[model samples]
Target: MLPKCIGNLSTTLTAFSSGGNRVFGEIPEEIGNFVNLEVLFMNLNQLSGVIPSNLGNLRNLARLDLSDNNMGGTIPSSLGNLTKLIGLSLSGNNFRGQIPSQLSNCRSLDSLDLSSNNLGGAIPPQLIGLSSFAIILDLSRNHLTGVLPKEVGNLRALTALDISDNLLVGEVPSSLGACIGLTSLRMGGNFFHGSIPQSIRLLGGIEELDISRNNLSGQIPEFLAVLHSLKILNLSYNKFEGMLPREGVFKNVTSTFIIGNNELCGGLPEFHLPDCISKSSKSKKINIVILSTCIIFGVLGVAVILAFIYLCWLKKKVNKPVPSLINSSCPNISYGELLKATDSFSSTNLIGVGSCGSVYKGILKDSGIAVAVKVFHLVHHGALKSFTVECEALKTIKHRNLLKILTVCSSIDYQGNDFKAIVYEFMDNGSLERWLHPSATSSHGNELPKKLNFIRRISIAIGVASALDYLHHQCHFPILHCDLKPSNILLDAKMVVHLGDFGLAKFLLGSSHDTVANQMSSMGLRGSVGYAPPEYAMGCEVSREGDVYSYGILLLEMFTGLSPTDNRFGDNLTLHSFVAAALPERVLEVTDRIPLLARASVWESLVPMKCLKNG
Candidate 1:
């Protein structure tokens, strides 16, 4: 016998699973005292008696599986109180009575199985309206009767629905066509009459459909031939007549069972059906003539329209004035060419957005070269200046670690806007920001955590350093990169870092004027917050030393996995101060463990001491 003292352990219990135990006895009513229980699985047991109504006290219960038990009683109406219930399986039991309509209150239910029970009465309309049923809803092998409700269409996300082996009657609901996500539907072994609904064609993703052993009478739907995703189809023991489709799943006689439908004719030779006789030979000839006439007229109409549109496009091209390139060193790509390449600057092509402009991924039609087009938003303050500075800075510099500028578009757009765009070689991989902080949701709705190895981090740091070294010392006129951050660092297919975004770049010229730097310095802050040095906050001129300060912070962020702008840092506590406290001993605590593990061999030999000393 189960201990009644189970209620004493209920206060802290979140789960009580004793599945497949074959525990013979009535489930202790005290089991319901577990108010915090989220999962209660006692399946494959010989437990009997009424399910404790007190189980409803578990408001957090997400799953309650009591299948394969000898429990014989009405499902507790109080169970409906579990609003967070995602799965409720009471199958393979002797429970008898109408399924509680109160179960409809479980709005989060993804799977609900009450099969192999003595459940009778009309299927609950509220139960059929559960749109969250993305998994399975099996009520098969039961004494369920009456017409299937149109509310079944509300289960648009349902993948599988098995209501077979029941006493269900009346025509199949046409609203079932709204279940477009259904991959499997089983309504066989029932008394369903009338032709298959034409709306059934909407289930283009159906992989398995079993409507066998029904009173269904009509020609098989030809649209079934086009449901390419279908793998198994059973139309056996139905009253379906006429020719079976010879395409798609129907072509495979073994996978598609259509036995006992005596009137059915003309399918794949493997089906061994009687040949379909042609009855309207004269009408068929007239129909063919009409179709041929329509085809000729349709072809002629399409050709004329296409020719007129092409002529209009050519005339517009001839009238449009071509914009000149900013410099002879780079290619001269027109605004129209780029507009066509990026689908007129569609949001889908947009890759990144900054204070001054948005970057779009484009492929030139003429050369088939993939490029990144940085289009300046002229409406923003200092945007035009950023554009000019970038063009001037990029034209003078050339380095492996630097972003390669392919061309510059200083032109007016079709909308008569002051459009200025700079084109660069497209980076196959995205920015370092994404790698540093990967999102929980992806395009495919999967959690993808991006990991950067120690070696790759070192390589990126080295590449950025090389680009900075070139700008500060190797350039004809030393340039100061005012803004240097992870977002500005782009990676290629080989993971080679390209230091980009020279919008705030200042050229250091040995002159008395100090015009550009002086004007930019007056803007208060030069670079991103936390990245701009402390001196910059005091209205100091942007310099290579400031770049070095930002670089130090960037390096700290890469290794320690703590952003300088993280909420933890404040007035007294800075990223530098935080790291200083951790020092050489507690450095392991501050840094990311994953990369540290990857570079374990080099930690003592190369990284720790040097990073501590420099960082």
Candidate 2:
């Protein structure tokens, strides 16, 4: 017996199970006092009498199982109160009377089994139409009567259904075809009559079908042979007649079992069935004439369909607009047009080499709009993937600090080889790398030595930070800039920084709180050697913290005018250590003298000597 003292525990208890035990006698009424219980299992026991109606108090209950017991009585209608119940099983018991229509209130029920009981009365139409019944619905070996409800079609996700061995009458509901996912259907040992519905052909995924021992009449459908997934079909002890189909699963004798149908004949020779005799000559002539007429009409229909399709294709070609870019709202340019604008990719038009490809300066012939075209080298590893990633990243993101893609070209070149490129608004001032370390020999006639003041450097840093912040927090998906260095940062005519080069970008699928260990990456280590985080070398996953480390290094390089890759630092000394050692006393020793002297007055106002002395 369930101890009455068990109910004395705290109301916080959420589960109580006493199944498969020798425990007997009436369940103590106090058992229902655990109002907070969400799961109550007392199956496989000898507990008798009706289920406690007070169980309705568990409004938060999600599962209740009481099968294989000696309990006798009508199912408690109070179970309807479990609005959150996802599974309810009360099969293999002595419970009788009509199934409670109140069960329809369990809108969350996915699996329900009330089989092997003495349940009587018509099956509730509301219960049959419960859309949440996705897993299984077993009401077999019951005493249910009357026609099967048409509402059974509502179980679109149900995989298995067993309503066999019942007292149900009338034809099986044709709407059962709506259960397209059904893998097994058992309706045997019933009083169902009439020919099997033609809609049964729609159960293309059915693997097992049992409709034996029924009052069903008419010839077995030839369409049954075409259900490729069917493995076992049992039509024994039925009133089906006529010759059996010889194709598909029907050809295998062991897979199909049909017995006690005396009128059936002419199956495989293994069945030892009598041969079907030929019809009279007059009937043969009629069949030949019908077959010849059908062939003529079928040929004419095919020719007509082909001619109509050809006419539609010709019409579409004549009126089709010029081939444009992916986003049709923008101006369109073809591959040949871009090639001519770039002077056939001449060496004079070359701008710079990137991670995946080379950049070329070009001007549109009609509009004369200067643009930078990046052509990807398909043979290089990860080159195509980088182009695809960059395109996808730029399409959904837009900001003043982010590079804008004017258009893209995905077509064949003059030599018939594949070509892929992206065009973007030209940055006249070139990359931050060129600005920081000017080349002695200039290719472009307008090339001039450029320098950034202290204030300009701060503004550029703020712009890059704003772009990174948007990518990490504001977007629908977080984007990680795997590479963050001076070369990837561009400056326009006004010296406004624009973050570009998303070739190695990664979009995180998880939330911000997820640990770096849980993140995934196909590229091994990210960022350049000195700028990359220390954890990256250890094969640890990448995170936003890695980007912050790179930014910190970049900031240090800006003020010190020393690259992290400079040969001055060797085994023991790094850029970080070098900057750390030169603190308050020797700070000006490592500073960039040219820019520092130009902004001396601003530096004095920004950083007082007293603050450095106190530190």
Model 2 clash count equals 0
Ten contiguous residues minimizing lDDT sum, candidate 2:
512-521
lDDT of 2 by residue, 1-615 (tens): 878887798888898888899878777888788888889888899888888888877888888998877676788899898899999999877676779999999999999999876676789999999988989999976667688999999999999999876767789899999999899999976768899899999999999999976778999999899999999998876788888888878899998978767788898998666765456865898899999989799888999999999989988888654433233236446789889879998888998886679999998776667888899986565565566567656755788898888887766688876577888888988888776666632556687776778888889889999989988887655788878888788889898888988877777756321211111133356678888898989987678989889889888887887888889988989999999999867988988765786667685778997874576
Local distance difference test, candidate 2: 0.80
Where does candidate 1 stray beyond 4 Å? Answer: 280-615
Ten-residue region with minimum lDDT total, candidate 1: 512-521
User: Which residue pairs show backbone clashes in model 1?
Assistant: none
Clash pairs, candidate 2, are none
TM-score versus the correct structure, for each prediction: 0.46, 0.46
Task: Estimate every model's Cα lDDT from 0 to 1.
Answer: 0.83, 0.80
Give per-model CA RMSD. Answer: 28.3, 27.3
Tens-digit per-residue lDDT, 1-615, candidate 1: 578887778477898899998687888889877878898899998888879888898899999999987787789899899999999999877676688999999999999999876566789999888788999999986657689999999999999999986768799999999999999999976779899999999998999999986789999988999999999998987789988899999878889999878898898888999888666865898899889989798888999999999988888879654444233354468999999999999998988899999999998886667889999986775675576567657755789999888887866788876678899888987788878877621333464677898988999999999999999998756888989998899999899989999888888866422212322332347899999998988877778899999999999999988888889999999999999999978978998876987787666676677675676
Off by over 4 Å in 2: 1-328, 440-446, 511-523, 605-615
- Candidate 1 residue 403 Cα shift, in angstroms, is 89
